[model samples]
Target chain A: MRNTWPGAGGSCLAESITRRSRLLAAVVGLGVLVVGGGCGRAPESTPEGGGKRLTIGVNFETLQTEYWVAGFEAIRSELKKRGIDVVDSIADGDSSRQLQQIRTFITRKVDGIIFVPKDARTCIPAIKAANEAGIPVVLFNRPAAETEGVRSVAIVADNRKLTRETVSFMVEQARQSGRKHKAMVVVGDLGDANAIGRRDGFYDAVKGNEEVVEVVSEVPSEWNQEKARSGVVNGLQAHPDISFIFTSSDFLFPAIVAALKSANKYHKVGTPGHVILGGFDGDATAYQMLEEGYLDATGVQDVYFEAEQSVQAVLDLLAGKEVPALILDPGFVIHQGNLHDLKDRMWGARVMGR
Target chain B: MAIGMRVDGWLPGWLKRGVLSDHLILWLSVAYVLGMAPWATGFVSVSNAQTILAYLLPVLVVSVGLTLVLIIGGIDLSVTSIIALASVLGAKVMSGEDGWMAGNALAVPVGVLVMLAVGLGLGAVNGFTVAVCRIPAFIATLTTMMFVSGFAIWVTLSRKIGGLPAGFVMLGQNLWVATVMAVAVTWLAHGFLSRTLYGRWFYAVGQNARAALVSGVPVGRVTFWTYVASGGFAGLSAILFTAGLETGNPEMARDNLLDVVGAVVIGGTSLYGGRGRVLGTVFGVLFLALVDNSLNLVGLTFYTITMVKGGVILGAALLDTARTRILARTG
Candidate 1:
């Protein structure tokens, strides 16, 4: 005779039932925790103006880089000072999950939404959903597609122009050297609009200067360090004479350094065998590299400026004020020439407490 | 006559040996290298060889461990996440800036041990879920992967931890050291699979779990240990990656899952389990590294390289199916 009691079972059937019950309990418990946590936040006290605190939902693609982390912190802290509450979500580079997050924010009745899209096109529906719920949406650092019947304020840097300016400085240096230099360009993921803009900007700067700087290789990094390292190593092997290197993002500097070191080419700017390096998105690493005389120039996106503008745009929309659909931050290229004067303005320098 | 028989007759006697039959991908990879040499500048040079080997070390190490899990009819989708988590955790212990053991002589060793411990602990959790709790390996490992990845990012707030001690970073910069580590791991794993009773139990269990249990093979123990071994190997791979990249990043190896799985499968590891070889996996890794290196040397776009890689993997899978059918007929 088989025992049917829950604790009496050494039998398979008893074990199966016990396991099922435990699993069910766990699932139910998790659901309750999620729901309770969502509803359990302490409400902020009303301001002196006798209005309820404004709660905003901010969705990020991924905080895998310093730029996104700085931007998120800036916006969150700045909004807190204004008595605004923030609910944050990071999609970790998943567009479908980002859409779901937006839906959750809508269900929570968030007053406004700010998001950095994983891609230009797939995130439009998320904006549309916010619009349908009568919530203002602000696109941060990345713009949505120009879909008719959709409205949102986008705070973005001019990636192409800034990249062109940075590369132009690299070109000027090459011209001063009075030699034709073989070049390698490390391109980022083509799916990202910023990556595309940077790549095009690189081409724009090198268009007529082919006589001074000839691009010998285009290494596609997909914003991954390992891929960048491998691509640079292989590119150097194929073109050993490459002296000019430009990467789409500053985060790839370590990878470039490693690859160049392996090839016995890494040196100071004034030293022989030194590869002239230029990067975009001036991060702390780029700042250090520039100071060390290893990096020639970097396209510095004003993260603090962009973050402030993004929040201001959302607040303006809530105030029934008209704003332009696109508020652009015309970023500048920082090189050694003006590093001393403008170091404070570079977000990466500020983050490093330099 | 069938094309296979005709081709067999054209082959040399040594090449027709049964041992050589398992290494068809090896010969094909060699042929590929020679074929691409003329078109791809510097494809066959010594410096390029170093690049391929250095990059191949981490992936190969992880795949070697993954092969054991596959042999036991289990899947581990969390190895990449383990690499990332282990990297950051270990980096934190040995980092030059305020690390737990900063400026201490034992920092490097202790940090390495911590990485291994994390891998083993995570693996044990997976083993317990699948072996004891009866959760499917796929679902258990998938959940573990998601949790570990998220936890890693949260620990560092997605900031990269750099400034590792020189002694620790040397392991990655020295090609000879990395090569020795990778070779030793592969040799030990191969010996375990071929020369031990426990190893044989893995194949038996994978072939038919119920039958193995009836045969008193300790199916649960074998399944549990296989995942643990895979995790430990991922930890070792993490050390190499963290040292090689010279930074501890939460996003390290995020794009390497396909390479790991693809290399193992292309090496003729049966996804359904019960059969695989360490040597075959080595050649599979070499084949992929060569393809990636050569495509870049040829200046092909990333899109083109991706499509070409996908095609190659598909062809290898088809070859695996044909090889299995031939072996069955011979038996």
Candidate 2:
């Protein structure tokens, strides 16, 4: 049956948030004026530059992804440790509202803003405002789709590096097993730049490796387990591959696992055959699969490290120091042997208080 | 005898065609046969049925909501985008991934209520503009469609938020729960329209807005509430989606709106509204789920699926047109 779609408070939430934002800005401005009056200094663009106050803004596409929560908390904590004031504005995943929040941040006169833009194109206006306001930005997780001149340093896991290496492990497994042959690839939302990168990375590395003709069929699962699981079901029926299978992310590992389990791929020749399915991210299932000697391997992207690097990038930028274009490599591959000890490593459990 | 009856000015051409071509019966048989064939090639077994249903639940729920709105002659283009909004918001409010029990319990009430309110509010906007300002429902909802979809991606000031507590897993992960939700929405909506006064008004409004107005019906108010009801259902469907994902991303439901509307229309429901039953919408939804699930088993590319879906819609429209003509001639 056809169902309807719902939303949040209409004009009420909009009107209220607007008033609250304006009021908060006014209050922060007055407080700044009083502090500046006593110090007898114009707003030192970089407040923390010379024994001063600094406000850092944390802009999230929306605080809805678990990985980002730990990542953002780390950014907030690290910046706080450096004596920086953290002002976070969650857009709830609305691109326009996010643009509005960025504008609001600029109006609030924050020293620096950390943005996780939902839409790369919609980010221009907001990024421009922050740039014009002399606020440096650090992007976390995914970068703006096409950031030609957006003044931001993205502290993401070397996505290409991670996926390429993980696929290499699967290839090596197949080589070691003497079952070097064909493979199939199940993918996520093609619209996402991240998914595109992961898919291309895996295909590029695997396609030319051998005569292993991989049939890559995509279902727009969009990183969801159900959809991914369904994609696996589709793939199994479509291609009777002679080799490895790769799902783009660790989040999809469980779904791939389910698809394999249902297909009884677990029944093939002595032990679970050399049919390896790969994933990306450090989610529980990805780690568990390694612990149980499940599929092949996964590429781990530490949320905490990404967050810490984002903070460092902002600090270095503000200090007028040359910041390296660093790609933090989160550790990868969890096999049956080390699964127990890595329980706490799944999320930033020990790192962030959350 | 039929020609003689018509000659007495007792029937119009369309009416004569309707009695013969209402072909609501064909959608199910056709959808089922089409759905089963690919799966029959040793791909889709009964064990896979549960798995497919799990994947289909969220979409099914949204389709049901769209069905209700379609009957009232209103459309909710924002259903997909609103799903994104609810999923994200629900995730943000949850305690963590396993927080399904308490987290979803509390969140469900709040999320559902907010969705309901938003649904009504948005529907009111469409209804008001369409009814009061004389805007087409399609145009009004389309504007809202753009806004909600933009909101799904734009929110969070640019960060992905996730922490659904363990409790939410059961809320949507449980097949029974999802099924219950689907049935509940369809039944409530069905009851409201088929057995209630408000429902009749929807039919009356759809049958002829000017006639409905002249006949002492609160045409504008009915139209407005029709949208509100449609939106409320959208919110409910979104909440279910958050439960299913165990994490909400604002961009997740961006592809669902058209599918939901398509299901409604495919179920033998007229775009003119006031004529289709919830049963028809339900069957339409099931037929779609069958097609979608079966397509996955056959491993068709998304592009192929798109073509199939588009073809299905066009075919349904043709069936509708053909039936009306046949009924006019025969009945």
Candidate 3:
């Protein structure tokens, strides 16, 4: 009776099973191919000299942004010139994965480790593991939590101070416009230390300039362009008189531009009704906008400087020299006035083939 | 009499006739809009309406297809990933910056085709795994979601591609164009579900695959095509989002998955399958869009808005359960 049914017939059943077997084979074959391709890269050989070449393990939070990509490339190229081998892994924003990668590096007995943590506090265990393993660790571009026992060398930009300078530049521009201004601050993910520091910096710069700049809206972007666009549109609708805008990062410039253009307010700096714009991360978009007279200022993090410092710290640690617990890159604010002179120093410009 | 029957008996004739019970979300949405207008600045303005519509269109387009998948007792977690992959691939075809057909007049059409192709292709992969391999839809779609997302990021090196030709971008810029597209898609989907024989097969397959097969329905074919249709819808949504943002972003629509799924479920769609309506999904999307816009205008923090929206979805779900029980008893 079952075999007599439409889908339950013997021929149909046989064909179904055959098709399922074929699909299983295909899926398994594809998986093997992917895994094989991922493992194809060979490790670097020893240098020409007779001396044993040092191997360093570099762990990254994510390379999704141009800033992180530039930093990673700078570190790799710099280490390559000195004949050092680097084994790197990216956690892709998973703190637990970052810890596991660090442990793997410790197991491999790498001479040193440089890692950008996903979270300030969750990374303490990774640092502790490296410390116990007697491997020198360098925190690259992101500082770990201020724990009592865990120790590591941190090389990062002064995020708050740099953002304060950047926002102050915008405040000055608003002051010079000779009228009180409504402002919007596009805040990043609050969980990130750098984002919090930048938010504080905006507040710090706007503290005494209340008469010139009144912040009417704080659009929480959460580091996503879609969220940034939506928040900016809603903020603009609520407060259409907004004449000043600052984003936590430069990657969101595209979202801001779209929102402003939709509202017919995306004008150049000198144009009437132009909104004073400022951003951090000094990415390629910010550089182009500043050059085109649409952006007022951007906080430049000096990726090359940070990368060089991180590599130096690792090398110094390997030499039995005591490196500073904290290495600060006092980043500068790049604006239209200084853009021409500092174009060569800006990593964004460098990435743009300038 | 049962408690549900007693409750139904006190209601007005229209209420007892199942109008309110069937379209509860619609009434709740209307009440929300009227109630929020007084408190949220610009909540009733034309400009705010445009803003809400812009935000609503992409989510609506994606949810319309998701409604079908849910109706057939399947779920596709790869819809957002499809949007991202399609957005970037399509942008690569039509972008003014070193695009394949950069200066060509057919750039927009070709780009649209590529985006749809990516969506359909990925959807086909998902369908084959689930229908042919007999794998669970959840696991198959989840695997596709992860791989497609990673592939998209790899394709662009995590960089957003800009310089999309103005002609392609104009589709996103014009509100009327987006509205027409969304409405046409929704109307067609609604008709297919309400007035077609194949659509009836989807419900039968979802309700009981064995029974559907006994009734001479091609269960595997129906399941396969439902996922393909979903993929096509997600691809169409990618075109709107890419054009609207004026860039091909690998992370496009990454945060909208929860919204799409939540909206569908909140609109009285049964997660266990065999029951849903396209009209219900529309009201669900509208309700979410309204809440999001009003909260943003009121200057509430993102966290606060998220909490409020979660509460509203929970309330809607609870109301759906009560309404179902009451209707079953009264009938």
Candidate 4:
């Protein structure tokens, strides 16, 4: 409605030109570096299974989230040992920017690229751009847009299977505890595919286990801790009778612990030791907490390994080797007894992450 | 209708006043409670109220300044973006383990000064655009918001920088901090509204810019400064909120604009401008916070809360119109 709402910021000709030039130069320089760095030479990379020292541009949907960070770390360590460089452009689950990062990788002409897209569908244009540029791509953690030529290798903890495993394990533990304790399942982001699977899986596991009445609460957190913190706190207060908070991600467990710890009722719930906080994606913090008697059990995920496997799949494509469209396998869940066994593996991964 | 207070002959005094009243705000609150009674009774509890208040403090702080901008018939969409920028920049400044900007140093007067200056400078940009360039407040603030958010996200790069020593999250998370802030902002905003000439000028500008200008008021200057003040308040909230979260995610507080607006509106401030009190906005904020807190305690979904909020806004609008009509006919 305002005709005189000042000209657009682009009208400042001199400043605009300067900013544009700088931006353009930066972009060009980045592209050249990516091409040079990724496609170095077959001569240098001769022995020990070597080729052009490829730079695999790996963009993640927020390395901040538990599962994705693990996946990225795995890719980084595996490739680092194999002499492959990875230029990471990580997004904190922003859909638009995730696509932009992917497009940028395409423009940079990297030897190969991998991405865990934010939205399953919106990232197609970016994926198509990489395809047009003849850059091999591998998607991990989450699925691809439409699944064309991009050798998508997701190292998913097989949500459906893990959900079943998580519930089954927790139920078994509860049954063994023999203490007629009821548990409430705190799900993060109920609408999510994995969340639904876990919810259904829990129901499947505990439907017949009459000991667990499954006192559900209102307002699913959508996987946000702040949201889940309140959800759990209220869940605890209203249904002090509830136990066994089976969540979707490790991110929510920390909040659940914080909430339950604040209430001091956390000790009263679950299998007499720690509350049964079961979920997928093996976060280091959650893993440690389990060993410390803060948790009963958790369904683990190999996020970093998954990302690495996906990257390897891309390399496989480039080397004229066969690539699978769906790389599906369930990562194992480690209890207190087995958590220590993962210590060496975790330490090794941490060292490699650097 | 018979008990209507009249001033202009049979004309009611309420009619002379614009759409933003305590009664109207109260009705909105009632509507929110009633419309989502199923969800409210379903989940929210006392502890849930604590969580909501914890999140609501930063939003209320920002809204305090936002009310000022709205009072002068302007809005600042840039508050959201400013928060993101401050968060990222704060992370960089406070990155050191025990350095001047890191950990224990966050409570020092120096850190406070830096925080204020950052907020003030960001606000000044919006002020300059609306004041010197004579751009509409909406357009100027919107562009600034987009630019600031973009830069903030770019600077942080998907990382949520944490480890703020101790007490970093106190200002945003502590009940005492929230109460102190709410009281202080209320007193300050009330003084600005009722005790200041510039504040009076803002009212005049909102009511009728041409009349205010003709009567020797500097409308542009008032509009500009309001934006600056709004931005500064936003920065302060950003710093406090970043502390509360204990991790500065450039992505944090991105969706809080809705709450800020809701607080001001539910407090009985007209989005159309010219008629709303800061104190009223504070009450509105508190009311919304109460609702948000109550939602969790009662076990309601985020989606259900949104639905309740919509109903509350509608109820507020209806009451505002009703009161306006009643006053006009009686007076």
- Against the true chain A, what TM-score does chain A of candidate 3 give? 0.85
Candidate 1 wrongly placed segments (more than 4 Å): A1-354, B1-20
What is the lDDT, from 0 to 100, of the residue B300 in candidate 4? 35
Query: Roughly what TM-score does model 3 have, to 2 decimal places?
Result: 0.52
Predicted model with the maximum lDDT: 3
CAPRI tier for the interface of model 2: incorrect
DockQ, every prediction: 0.02, 0.02, 0.02, 0.02
Q: In angstroms, how far off is A282's CA in candidate 4?
A: 1.8
Question: Per-residue alpha-carbon lDDT of model 4 for B175-233, expressed as tens digits?
Answer: 56665776687678779888998778988988888899999999888877788788788
For every model shown, the clashing-pair count is 0, 78, 0, 27
lDDT, candidate 4, A237-321, per-residue tens:
8877666677767767778878877876566323454566676666766666665666666776666557567767887878888
Model 4 lDDT on a 0 to 1 scale: 0.63
Query: Across residues A1-354, which tens digit of lDDT does each residue of candidate 1 receive?
Result: 110112111123332444455424432332232222223332122223456778788878888888888888888887888888787767666443455456556645678988898766556657766787789999999987566777999998899999999999999999988889999999987656788889999999999999999999999887889989999999999999999999999999899999999999999887888788999998989999988888999999998889889889999999999999999889889998999989989988888883
- Residue-level lDDT for B130 in candidate 4: 82
The CA lDDT of each predicted structure is: 0.79, 0.61, 0.80, 0.63
Query: How much is B194 displaced in model 4, in angstroms?
Result: 34
- Residue-level lDDT for A152 in candidate 3: 94
Predicted complex 2: DockQ: 0.02
* Residue A57 in candidate 4, Cα distance off native in Å: 0.4
Q: What ranking emerges by TM-score with the best candidate at the front?
A: 3, 1, 2, 4
Clashing pairs in 3: none
